[model samples]
Target chain A: MLAKSFNIHIDNQDLLDEAFTQASYVNEHKGQNLKFYERLEFLGDAVLQLIVSSYIFQRYPKMPQGRLTRLRAAMVNEKSFSTFARECTFDKYIRLGRGEEKAGARNRDSLLCDIFESFVGAVYLDQGQATVEKFVQQVIFPKLDEGMFAEFFDHKTELQELAQADGPVDIDYELIDEFGPDNDRSFKVNVSIGDKLFGVGIGHSKKAAEQRAAQQALTHFDTEGDNLV
Target chain B: MLAKSFNIHIDNQDLLDEAFTQASYVNEHKGQNLKFYERLEFLGDAVLQLIVSSYIFQRYPKMPQGRLTRLRAAMVNEKSFSTFARECTFDKYIRLGRGEEKAGARNRDSLLCDIFESFVGAVYLDQGQATVEKFVQQVIFPKLDEGMFAEFFDHKTELQELAQADGPVDIDYELIDEFGPDNDRSFKVNVSIGDKLFGVGIGHSKKAAEQRAAQQALTHFDTEGDNLV
Candidate 1:
């Protein structure tokens, strides 16, 4: 499928299969000598980071480190990767266990994101870094150039601007709750604008939760008849 | 310096200077057309991640994603990168403002780490990814192979083992205090072994503080007459 679409010929079909395989599938079929996508996801993540970083580095020679970091994060994050996977029709190619398939894992954002990374990893192994970079430039950079990723980087600032335009409104993001183990904690946050709760959000980290809250607030303003600016 | 050490010819010397120049130096010499290391650091960070990730991926084919992530973090972290910079004698090459130089910024871990990333970025631009990977393998992978980074990854686990060796003593890492602004907060942690405070540590994050506390506790055991096991 990748070859047909992207013209990236995989030298080893086994690597491609490994990239598509989910852990659940491997775990369920215990006797099968199947490799899952986790390892590939790990490598692909680094490959993606390097490609995006290089692209932006050369594209915007004067852009500062902090902004570049934020931009790279915006491009490579779960939401963006999942979107890319969907655009590539990865849902059609992903292999899942019966249980996972029943649970709609094929359409899951996290799973899709993982698959994208794993695919990149497979490509890296099969064709090398140049091929991987070319694939990224051809497939991903177009979306980036179209400003599809700008919202991911600017949600908080945009929310702030929208709030302040109404004249000195107190916008506060309060962490209402946190749960799970220390290594993997989810935080719930509420965004309040001038004593009124505008929106609520939940995320893996505090900053993520705050950003989501701001995004929610912006969405709330958009849904209403209120002009954002 | 890098060219002489690595035997790779640099196409642009100005880029090398830019990679060494701190933002403070650029700001101080406002009239001069100077570039800081931050941009290069951004690109180099990704380059470093890719190289390290690829190295470990090939070296430990069967390692799990969680462990791989932890190992990569240990290798690419500020402490590790700063150590690499020191090993390469980057302190002598880095350019800092007079005020920053007076404040001993040359030896600062954060600055050193940033400079190393910037250096890698410059090398990538000057020579390319293959050369950058070769440089990393030559300079950094030897230390990784020697298990110099084992302490960074295994501090908590080592501390746990040490504590549990003497009939399952309760080990607690308590967050005593957190301060500074939301973006850059510092956490102070105390590691208590069986109701006695063994060590105290401070870091930019809670997890880092806890790790440092464990490291300190381990060091205390090592230095004192008390046997860790």
Candidate 2:
């Protein structure tokens, strides 16, 4: 099944099984003596980092360290890994405990991210660095090339750069509203350029909301008026 | 110099030179068209992570993900990397700007750490993964085997386990003082077990200070009394 999905021959089936198995499942079924994916995740995390870092390092030779770091962070962060997991159909293969399965653990971003790393780890151990690097290049590099990273767009920085063109206009993101429970709270933010409220956005985090608001503001500037001049 | 120090035959001396060259040096000597080590540092950081993660994963099969993560962080953190750099005498080989050299940039932990990562990156690029892994195994695994990682020892966890053995006891770390500039601040912390002050420690950050205090407390417990019972 793993070979069919990933298009790589599995030399060791147990490593693949361990990659799919969650700690929750291992704890519940103590007699089975199954190893979880945590160790694999640790190993995979490093593999992913190296592959992504090398790709970016080669692709963008003139880019500064700070920018390279930011880009790499965006590519390998939890959200990005979760996206990769979904693309690879990891949710279908993931082994969760009865309670976790009932609670929709398969859809959880963190769990999905961990599973993706574990899969990489399994690949590294079973096949070796060359195979893992090829796999990551095929899987991840396209996403990076397509500008899936938030840092690639960087709406806030764009807005700031635009504002600076018009002699330092004061731009601010105000949290206009916040609601929902602690675990899943949403924030509504308004991006104001000087006195004008240009755009509003909603997100789970204040930073996300602010970025969205800034993006919206930039769009408004693009479509409606030459606000910067 | 690197070949003599690391005892590895250098296939590309230029790559080794690039690893030691600081950005400040590049800026100072504009016509030389020399590249800095930042890109290599970025690559090396990932390589280091993979190597360390593999080592720990194989060494400790039963350790939990959280503990493993903590242990990896301790081993690969700025302080640890800086220590490695010092051990390798990277300070003597590092290329700095005249101004930075005058300012003693060679002794800077951040610079040392960056240089160390760059060196690893250089090795990876020059000789490939097998050679780099052998180099890292020779240099780094010995430190891990010696329990150089504080998270491996885990003073806080040890203290908690010890306290549990003697019935329920409240352990707390209080920040007694914070001084110096924001960039180079020192934090003084006191660790108390029950109502008695067990140890006091000072460090650059609160967490470091707390860890030191806990370590000191554990040392006192080891020498003074059978605190476990």
Candidate 3:
């Protein structure tokens, strides 16, 4: 049953086995978990900390450690887990028992969070941090965006996805630099869809800068995007 | 002067003066700071990444990423920032110029950790991750033990400081026994004052469990000391 639950994506028997082991569910379901996500969660736990730590370190420049700690706690709590779980479509694929499903465990915040944690543990075991960080950075921190307010993140990602889509759309990002040592210079980024700039964003990463700029475009286009699927 | 050198913790006035801005000193001496620790580290773009994403999801028994992330990163990067800083005495009673020193700037870890990063930036801000982690864990992590290693980090502290005044004495720590689950085990420690049990110490804290055991005993005994200062 545990093995069957983990039968999504990768077909590597070893990965499936390790994923079961890390979750510590193999034997309870049948007899043995060749591997479990426990150790990987340990690894993932460390990975998650650094990702958020680095992000907070960058995002909230003068927010101070106290606020940073609280913000981190809020972002990585059950709420973030559930948010990421939906983004990853984890609830659809998790291996739960008749009992859990019958109990409506799918939407349970704790369960959702657990799956994400186990997911981290499994991924860390399967591919290591470099691989895992992508998943975290792409999925997790965006949860923070949602936390600041839910609608904002969806709007933001939509704009970013639209802008980053290389098919056949013209996107422009312009910056009016800030006053500072050019070495540590800051800038305000404005992103455009066609002519009039849609929105403005600021950040250190051209990616983050772009994301912020895209977010502004998103907000500006919110009315146009009201019925987006 | 004061405000500018929030990052500098020199005991020498000339050095403090050189590190300060006349405006910096005025701002700091007056007790305000837009500056903080790790500004330079952030400036250098020394971002730490999670090696993995939220894996515990979709993996096994279903733990969430939220709790998982916090536990995993307890020492992930900046845990390196913590425990070690305290141990090394990086900024314990730090000395600043009379201008900045009296503002209680010397006792700030945020300031301390910042200076620590600046010092790193000063030395090799552009160094490799391995070099950076090594310098921090070795140089800084051990420093996290300062309080842990405080008045009697070892028998040497007992001997050197106490022996000098009260003739001679032997100090020893015995584990006595270990208890609890391996991951969250508790340690029972006893410090011997010449074959007599000085006091007992216990902790559920991680890292240097054995040393912490000894450390707890030393601290408790020191507070209840039946001897002279």
Q: Considering every candidate listed, which one attains the maximal lDDT? A: 1
TM-scores, all candidates, are: 0.69, 0.70, 0.43
Ranked by lDDT from best down, the candidates are 1, 2, 3
Residue-wise lDDT of candidate 3 within B1-229, one digit each (tens)? Answer: 2223322233444322221222334445554432333334432223232311232222223333333343224433443444344554556524354656677665555555455444443333234334444554455344324543233234335333443346666766667767989888887776666776655666674334444544444454322231111
**lDDT tens digits, residues B92-207, model 2?**
98899999999989999999999999999988888877888888887888886576764456667777776666699999999999999999999999999988999898999898
Please give the TM-score for the first chain of candidate 3: 0.52
Question: Residue A43's C-alpha lDDT in candidate 3?
Answer: 50
Least accurate 10 contiguous residues by lDDT in model 3 chain A: A220-229
Q: What are the lDDT figures for the candidates, one per model?
A: 0.84, 0.82, 0.50
Which is superior by DockQ, 1 or 2?
1
Residue B32 C-alpha lDDT in model 3? 47
lDDT per residue as tens, model 2, A1-229: 5577667877888889999999789879888878889878988998888888888777776656766787788788899899989988889998989999999999999999999999999988889888888788777888755767645657788688667666988898999999999999999999999899988989999999998888788776432222221
C-alpha positional error of residue B26 in candidate 2 after TM-score superposition, expressed in Å = 1.7
- Candidates sorted by DockQ, best first: 1, 2, 3
lDDT of 1 by residue, B144-215 (tens): 658787663467886786577668888999999999998999999999998999888899988899988887
Root-mean-square deviation per candidate: 16.8, 13.8, 17.6
In model 3, where do residues sit more than 4 Å from their true spots? A1-24, A34-36, A59-67, A97-102, A141-229, B1-26, B29-34, B38-83, B86-89, B92-100, B103-128, B136-229
Q: What fraction of the true interface does each of the listed models get right, in terms of native contacts kept?
A: 1.00, 0.97, 0.11
Please, what are the lDDT tens digits per residue for candidate 1 over residues A14-101?
9999999998888788878888999899999999999998887777665556556777888888998999999999889888999999
